[model samples]
Target: MYSSPEQGGLLLSSLCLLSSLLLNTPLCYGGKILVYPVEGSHWVNMKVLIEELYDRGHNITVVRTSTSPYIAEKSPMYTSITIQNDIVFHDFFDSFIEMQIKAQREGASALTFLKLTKDFLSMIGEAHYLSCKVVSQMLDDKEQVKRLQEAEYDLLLTDPAITVGLVLARYLNLPVVLNVRWIASGEGHFAIAPSPLSYIPVSGSGFTDKMTFIQRIQNMLFKSIIMFQQNFVVGPIYEAMCTKYFKDGCDIISLLQEADIWLMRSDFVFDFPRPTMPNVVYIGGFQCKPAQPLPADLEEFVQGAGEHGVVIMSLGTLVNKLPADMTDQIASVFAKLPQKVIWRHLGKPPSTLGNNTLLVNWMPQKDLLGHPQTRAFVAHGGTNGIQEAIYHGTPVLGIPLFFDQYDNLLRLQERGAAKILELAKVNGPSFEQALNQVLTQTSYRENIQRLSSLHRDQPIKPMDSALFWLEYVIRHRGASHLRTSANRMPWYSYHSVDVFLLLLAAGGSVLLTTGLLIRFFWRTCQNSKNKIKKH
Candidate 1:
């Protein structure tokens, strides 16, 4: 017999509460933490966390991505390692590269190719959804299950990139934590940057908040598209490939769905009104200690910016392909600033420069943030950049380019931690004013500092909380308590407004018709009686 949705909800809620309580209680056993890093930042943060955990006497075993050559440069750690081969699709490589060549030759934007790739991947994602049966078959592979069993990890930790790990986690007798590398969403978990876009109901227009019927539908549709792109397109394509190559039989989505905890690499103080899940934690500021000492010249550059010293400007790695005009505009803007600027401009410096501005290829970002005189940040508003600025209690002037950067800056501006200069409109005059506004404003400084303090004051550092919760699940045999409230109900049932309105309309119509019939019959009877008495 199927359990009522209410009972399921109650069961899930009870499980979550019990698991949370158990996790909070100290236990004698602290098991090994298995970490997976797919990107450069992941490698950096995971190394820091693993070392910290190892220092605290936890055994660390790493299931790292083979693609990252940067791991070889890492400092020696006592942790055990098993590097998994990255799942690269040969067909996808051929197709994407061909498209890239065509776009390059035609002078068509790479953005167009990106769109096509995204759409193709999204369709593939949908295919996986439709082929859930095939996924179910793959996940049933016993050999893959045995690998997880053999790892004997007390807890499994993975970056959000390889969601297939999540599926493996479900079969293994260990607690699982997802380390989010970016803004967190439908992972059905919390991380550093909660889905700001997910929660905010985007009603149209400048002033009033009401959305027209059509607009409301459109909003939901658009939001669904975005969610689909993340969950189905990028995420699924990765998982499908992993399942095929690993022969693990487990689809990535299934793995992601099974995660018990979320370690958001973010400072919660920076992100306000975050969506809370049972086991999610924010620890965004963690980074591996830099290998080399800052060069004397770089140190001198930073130190020289004593009183009105540092304005750190960096567009991050991805968006460094800026046009010459934009680069010139940035240099021109910095020349006008009163404070000394330390710029990580990958391109050559503009011919015209004020003595206060210093441009270079790169700077140690975390070290720069640690500096006391570092007043304001000029950033692309990447998630990592935003959290670092917040952790250091520095405000920002965000010149967002694309993707999550737009949403990231919007939240920062809303929180009074930063100001926004749209990519399309940024020029010397506006850029200079933005920098001045961020650097001079007392409120921005105060606001970000207050948030940083709150973030630091959490009962547990996000990393520890993530570890604790994962172990709790393992100890409790997959605590099963932390499942989402949404999982208890079907999709239709979760969206109950349609059912509610339908019932209300039917009941109202019935009541009104009954009342009208009664009135008509009573009048007819009275009229008949009067006629009879007169006769």
Candidate 2:
């Protein structure tokens, strides 16, 4: 078909403009970054991150497994990919809810259902297997393979929950950056803990406690189990499966070892004397923002408390199932406190005798922390809670329940911003005493406010720093320079003591050989002397 002269001119002009942008500007569409989030809360943070990057003139793509009402209600500011393969946020959640209810009816609890869904995430090292599965499901998935093979992204950032991003990066030969919102579990040996406290057992002994002989033995067994599972069992099985299906060589740990950077959600102010690799960066509080206004009724209720304002109590997301006994203890303790307590009691309380205390199913934590009347926070010490409290300069009294909560509270105690009370010992008197101390004592509040000021006065916003590093990775073909020595070193070399023992064993072996040789020579000479005398 012959085109009009004007149409031909317009096409030529568009081509010229595209060529000019490529040749003249650093901003290009090809420097794409892919991010994978774990679940609900993590997705919220990822949404903020992607928006910032999108504003910075980069094409950003978010890959998520499920959607929540919380996320759906929020403004859709960025493009995302969900299981149904669409960017419609509401549609994704609608599909998810339907699938979830069906699965739930088939004898599945919420936790179990979520876990089962997460398991579908393919092991990154088993690229061959995943590729085969993809092909087997949809032989003519032109768009999917095209996206994979386009060589578009320079880096991949992902949460640990969906570690499949590691494989994606390996397949594409892109740099990987991990955004660790939660502390690494004791089970995973691949992650490097940037903070000293990150090494502490989440549920057990404090960092200061010495390990028992049995505990030491258990530690060894645990490490051995991890090695066996990752290297020999799960890893090899996945690799072989991949090979059988897709005929591609896949090695998960090798792929993980290739990650260029680990950006931790921690800061020196919160995590002191942390051991970090050269490549690991503390970008905690990144994208942390203050909460909006509280409900009018809650605000007035808090304001009416005057000098003895409301203390916020929350057990965080996971440990909402407080036992009746524990709830009674909390209720009794709050009844005695001079301050009004706003407890986020997820279930029915054991007893209700306090006129001063209020129980609610949900509370705006950041809003409460930032409120002028907020005195102190009684919490389970989730990383998010700590950050929000510290960010708002409110002191906290942490009643840690499980998994990293103790360690998190301990760190807060060290900072003089929070106090830790073992749940076993959190009775009425002890709780009241701790609450009184934090409310009356100037030191805790003073220290916390001071740290908050320092946090606020940082050179740049945390999100901006994160965005800069993220975009920089895409621009520079990934931050390969940020990778650590641990990635390159052998397992034995990683432990200096092992090398020392190896040298000591070699020296002992040499000395023993020399002594045996000397004894043999001496015996032979004596035998010769005896034979001469007999002659």
Candidate 3:
């Protein structure tokens, strides 16, 4: 069929546009970025972003501690400014993990939960206090402060887990972008967004968005605990830092609320739906991508399983080894499974060790999860691992240990994509049973696959979306317009309690005036009636 001239011109235009899109990159102009990342797993999450920004032709400078375990002093992607660490994160978390393991081994109970919460808060407070000192030291360094000021970077991208970055950004007067899911207070949402205890569950509450009356009470109690931790424990440390640094008073929460963008490490696919702000961008699985080629030996081992496939297990970076007896129990379960097992265990070999299981110090987790031979992921329910599992459509057999792991796993269990076993309840038989159920249940695989589909079906990939928002901020300076006025409002004003109270007072005044007037008229009429009767 021959097209008309007008139609031909339109076709030509469309083709030219397509060519322009495919041939040219979207992020062209590069800008200098200053990164303030937290140590440990948070660094792992932030690294993906730094690398992407680096490849896009941006100059990256990292501020790290002298004793940092993960973020090296030298890197090809970014320059580093190594500063003295008041507290070494590696040692701090190591001891914290040991305490957690000991607590779990004691037993799980209400008291145990509260005690752990207390201990967790204590550790958190110490870390934060030390971090505040570090920031103080950084600012006190006139030479380094001058260096940072002279560089005149476009923005500061931070994890805010430590939150020293917030103060640093404030001092530099740079546009702040947070690669955040957590702050010292709690989950990032509670501080900036409207979080109703009725639906939005506290991080450790284990309640989903739909809460029962009793569950809501429990959530409220948990929320109060977070408030206590924030106000009494962590808040003061940063507040003091703010006081010392700025002659003008500063509130830590205000600094966080004033951030230009929140590149939230969450999306609706993983996190439950809740009220959020305009500056908060959801990029849940931004770090996830197609798996690269596996190492030769790992591929051959995966192939050996043939029809049975592979079950990959890792407890994440924080926990080095499980309790000795618990390790033995888990190893026994792996021994019986027909599927080839790749267990990332650093502990001594279990007495019940089996030939079918490959015990490695570490494995290529992302690549292994993406492989077709992978059947299910045995994980500790860290956000990164769970998101990766969802990305690869792998069902989870979650052994949640400490902090928000249970909550992370709960999301999967709620979706029928996972099974959760308690630390105290995980005997050899129970471990075997849970593993079998995850493997045999067709629905587990199907449900996670559906989530994978949903997560994948987005207008833009999470990474790209995050980058666009970041560059958007750089191009336009701070995104204060997207920030809500509620941040500046006092508690009473924010909830409009003042307005409600004002209306109530007005109503009460009118009622009081009417009642007094009626009483006065009744008395006057009675007096007049008496006088008339007397006459």
Candidate 4:
């Protein structure tokens, strides 16, 4: 008897299902995912990825603090455990703003910038310790530990900057995926990614990918300084916290090495070429989307400029305050521009505010960038702002302040999409010239637009690529096969420096022995010739 086509299709489908089950493949089957995001704007990036996962039918539990309240409580697939009595990050942010403004006022030189950066990083290390302490207290509670243990989470997702998640994963013996929200920092030493000082500029080095001999030397020194900070400064703080919390004498470095994947917030289109392992996934622009409609007032202000267009100026959330003199200088430039200006100002408005300038506490930044009338972007060179500007093909006049801002702008300048205006030298003429150059020059717009196309022309959206990798890790149980052997090797061994030294020693010994034999033979011949002369 002939089987019907429906029966044949059903039989084939059953066979495939049975084969998958027999092989014990997880097949992206959804499971519990626990996420611990770093506080502040960093959360904005993490929220997008988490929501995507939740939409895919995965149960997600986010651990947040009072400082970062759960905003997705309405979602059925998402829940949060808020840690009360936590140190609000806003205080730290305010202190940071004070430090930055003070540095700017003091006319910080390169040396001063390095000093300030070291101090800032040191302060962050202390805060990381405090955050870990609070989380440890909660985790140490017997009831809480029992609840977490019973939860049986299949995967742990967290930002590498926050060590509490690493600690929790260790405590519960779960696999982890680290989401790094900025350019790769700390020399990639801990991450086992190849960071050649010859090309890869350190986070705050203020150097582009193409370096002169002296710049390469400077880059190497900066890398050494970064390593020192990570090991001597940040390492100890994390170690102490991990030891106290887990009581297992765990090292944070080891935990980082064992992470299943690293979702970096960087794209190769904007960054220089560098070697990366399979575990490193570039997910830049994951938070970026097609711009939404602007508010009515914003639309009117932008559209009202006609052909002159408008300029959007923002220095990001962390820098809520600016020095008065600098503000005046900026305002003076804006006043002369025919273009309408939308500035994201903080504290008090500048006395020099002009009729063409519109100052608001907050504006729709991405939407404005995407608007056709946006002639230029004046940014502090934060990664998010730079990425958004690039995504929307807007040219930028970058006034970098601290941390990675210099490096970020340097990369954009190298790509012909931006120009860096030193904050200390923000005069009206220079600012106007720089803004005019970007707005009038066809090259800047063309270059940035080209990059925007490259950024957007991906096989899959960055968010989807990230989600696929996340599920791939879950399906394969930590995906240990993707990890490189270099991750487990010593620094010297990984770089083959030990082998080089061994070869050098062997060659030196052989050369020394050959020299000695030649001298001995020469001495013997001289002695025989002297004896012959005496006879």
Candidate 5:
């Protein structure tokens, strides 16, 4: 109120400077993003990113197959472009899970495991073939291709689990951001990162980062399964499509490795400490949040447990239910537990079902995990579920069914945060025993709570980090500066086999020339000695 003229002028100048700085910064007028997501539980996490992007004012268009299971055609989050295609998610996985259950129930043999691997590979091959067909068909329609080209998308968001997304991103000439954990061949890191077999375990090898000599040999053999899938099963399908679509053919691995950014589905907390690249943004529990209020009835049910608390279980979206006998056995074990149990079971109600257990077709899994009254989680070890459990500090009693489930749970077991009960090992007593161990043992909760603290102790939230990097790509047009040129290098050059051979040849030549010079000098000395003797 009592400012002098000089002070008033100074204040006016500061205001002008602040206004100019604000104007010069430039605002982001939200971008148009094209998303081609993998269905099922993969969709669960990818949808979180899409939702956040929408909130940030970006326009999202999703590519969906008519037969897609998890990704619906209509949603407020995105406008979908549907392509008619073959069965991709549910039927294939359901039948495969059924086969595994039957074989294991009868006692799994070596051949049974082999046959399981073959069937699993076949299912993957067919999924890739069908998705490639979807993209190929879209490309065949000149009008659709012209429309997509005109859209001028800022970048493509996709999961490389479906190889067609990589091919489509290439054909459309869009900068890609992959929501990737699994590619068609194997785990995503094997394609894009430096994964040394000596320390980094292969996908299904049943070995940790610390390995003995025999384990290392076994790890190499397990790695061959990935190579087999890439070279023989999924590779040919995508290679043929690439040849027909692009004049210079492409392979899926190279296409994937060339992405603008990778929103890796895991962090070092959940994964082994292996080598990663600059482009990989760890958004392991990006979908997780603090618990919201539970429904009245569910809360009431949970409250009924009082001091005992509750235990929650889900087999994830892939498998509907376990074998009936196993289901009954699990039900019987739940009957004996003091805590109330809520299980997501799709099969017929077990004959041994008890009054204490509540069976639901679906449950708010993350919310339940975050609930204070919830004690332990019985999960099938999907990446999404595992990450949520880690975020909520929920110790898991894992029932690993198939795919990477065992590997995901293995990490928890090593950390002392979980205990694995194989399908083969799930009798009434064993089920009850494992559940009791996770619930009663203090170490399980303590260890997971510690992991939770470590995971949450980040400079920035994972979702925000993911969004910043994605928009970083959009702002820069592509993140080529961050991506390595190794993606384009040949196998020999990428692995430095050429450099090794060059050094070896140079040393070999030098040694040979030196040997020749020594031999000639000796011969000359002998001739001189003979001449002197004759003289």
Candidate 6:
């Protein structure tokens, strides 16, 4: 293959470009990465992402708990560090679930804000303690820690909700990438992004961006309550863990601030306008894909609904086992609907399962939502479910249970893509009316489709964007340049309220001193005049 002068030059240039690409590309392509996802939906949500990374030639090792056992097929590049503490993890989650069920049974209205706040704090504290304990146990095995350190992972990817992930990152001295599965909560403000409470609603505030004056006031109050709760309940656990595991004088907050990137599982389309640092990437809909062909049975069921379409009723994994009464009420509503109903029920099947309804232990939620025949979804307003619904342009009938579900449902309602069905007020009639409204109203469909378009209007797929950032961090050794100065600043200093207060204090002092001097001079002149007149 002898080439002419120009051809030879072109070949040489091509070779040079190839060499540059290979040399300049991120080192993470074949690097080892550790992922520590929290239990339940967090693990489920992370599965696709981790698999994608593995497909891209990255070495991934996950730390799996018993409750969140890794069920995904493993390849040479993908491995996991299974921590067997099934008893402890199960007991903790079971107790928490029992408490939630008890609260729901007591009626949502019966649980006052204070009680809810207290319960929420208690749960947070308990979860944190348990997580810390798990990490401690993991580290207690000196050989395990030695093996991990020996591996020299390129980066640490973890769920920010799990403080143990943060602790592990510190222990390994690795660059961190936080993978949060929800909108920025109060804890997120401390760990990931700066979500000002003035406009940004707290996780459970149930207030939208378009708030009334009173609602904003309530939001601020809720923010204060959350701050107090975080400090009082969660702070001690984190501190103790850091003190015990990390070196002396290690500040957990400062350690967390070192996080190089945050991959939040939310998009602006579904969230209020809030400030985010460069490193905070929105990978919403990363798990969403075009509708896959449903299973034979599910396909048959959905296809049978010609005109009335189908409605998916699921309370997500956490609330799959609903109370009998609640399930019966839901079933009763489904009985009246002309549309076919597919409810994800795990507990005792409702006795009133209508002819049109299919009660299954699990449903292909994303596929169902994307189906042309899917009319609406009844969900617990979980982040995963909501994102899938929005991705598929399906309107929702949200039965928010607790936590961020309430806020998420409120946002969807404000966007006109969903309606709320309060648990306390959930009855056959109300459920039927809400379902009928969503199915009959063209606006709900139109609004959700609009949002879906906006969500999908990005230049690249969200998964690609996430992978690029993850690799970018590794290529650069860390994406510290993307971090904001805000994370380093104290909360008061970040808001600059301290500076404003100082200025206000100085101005007030100047005004007060001037007024006092003027009064003193006036009184002295009056006394002198009186003395002159007497003389």
| Candidate no. 1 TM-score | 0.70
Residue 223 in model 6: shift from native, Å?
Answer: 1.5
Per-model TM against the reference: 0.70, 0.69, 0.95, 0.86, 0.95, 0.87
lDDT of each residue in 1-535, candidate 6, tens digit only: 7468899889999999999999986555577899887767877788788878988888899887655433443446468787766534445555665676667656656345467667767776777777777788888999999999999899999887765687888888889888875422353653556665667776677887667889888888887776676567777777787778766745446666788888888888998888777777888889999999999988998989889899998887665476778789889889888999998888787899899999888788888999999999999888898999989999999987777787888888999999998777777888888889999999999999999999999999989989988888788778888777876677799778999999999999999999999999999999999999999
Q: What does candidate 4's lDDT look like per residue over 1-535, in tens digits? A: 3279888888889999999898985467777898887866677678878878988888899887755542444456578877766576677767876777677767968898777867787776777777777678777689988988899999899987766688788888888888884422353333567667787777767888789999999988887777676677667866876767666686656778778888888888888887888888888888788899998878988889999999999998777778887788789889988999999998888888999999999888889999999988999987788889889999999998776788888888999999999877777678888888998899999999998999999988888779888998787768778887776788799779999999999999999999999999999999999999999
What digit string (tens of lDDT, one per residue) describes model 2 on residues 158-221?
A: 7754345665566556777777644222322235533222243322235422456665555555
**lDDT of each model, Cα atoms only?**
0.62, 0.65, 0.91, 0.81, 0.90, 0.80
**Local error of candidate 2 at residue 60 (angstroms):** 3.3
The residue-level lDDT of candidate 1 at 3 comes to: 77
| Cα distance off (Å), candidate 3, residue 508 | 1.2
Clashing pairs in 4: none
Q: Which stretches of candidate 3 lie above 4 Å from their native place?
A: 1-4, 11-28, 524-535
lDDT by residue (341-368, candidate 3, tens digit) is 9999896889988999999998999999
- Residue 339 shift from truth in candidate 4, angstroms: 2.0
Per-model root-mean-square deviation over C-alphas: 11.2, 11.7, 2.3, 4.7, 2.5, 4.4
Of the two candidates 2 and 6, the one with more favorable lDDT, higher being better, is: 6
lDDT for model 6? 0.80
**Which of the two candidates, 1 or 2, achieves a greater TM-score against the reference?**
1
lDDT of 1: 0.62
lDDT of 1 by residue, 1-535 (tens): 3379889888889999999999987673666666555444445666667666676667766553334444652445544343344433333434543453344335435587457546555444543343333323434667755665676777777676535445444545457776774422332332222344434333111111234666556656655655666664656555665555455554444456556666666554544354666655556654512224457887787687667778888877544345577678887877776668888876566766678888778788877876776888888887777877776778989876544566667667877888988765677788878888888879999988876776567676665665565556656755457666664466577679779888999999999999999999999999999999999
Cα error, residue 246 of model 5, in Å, equals 0.9
Task: Order the candidate numbers by lDDT, best to worst.
Answer: 3, 5, 4, 6, 2, 1
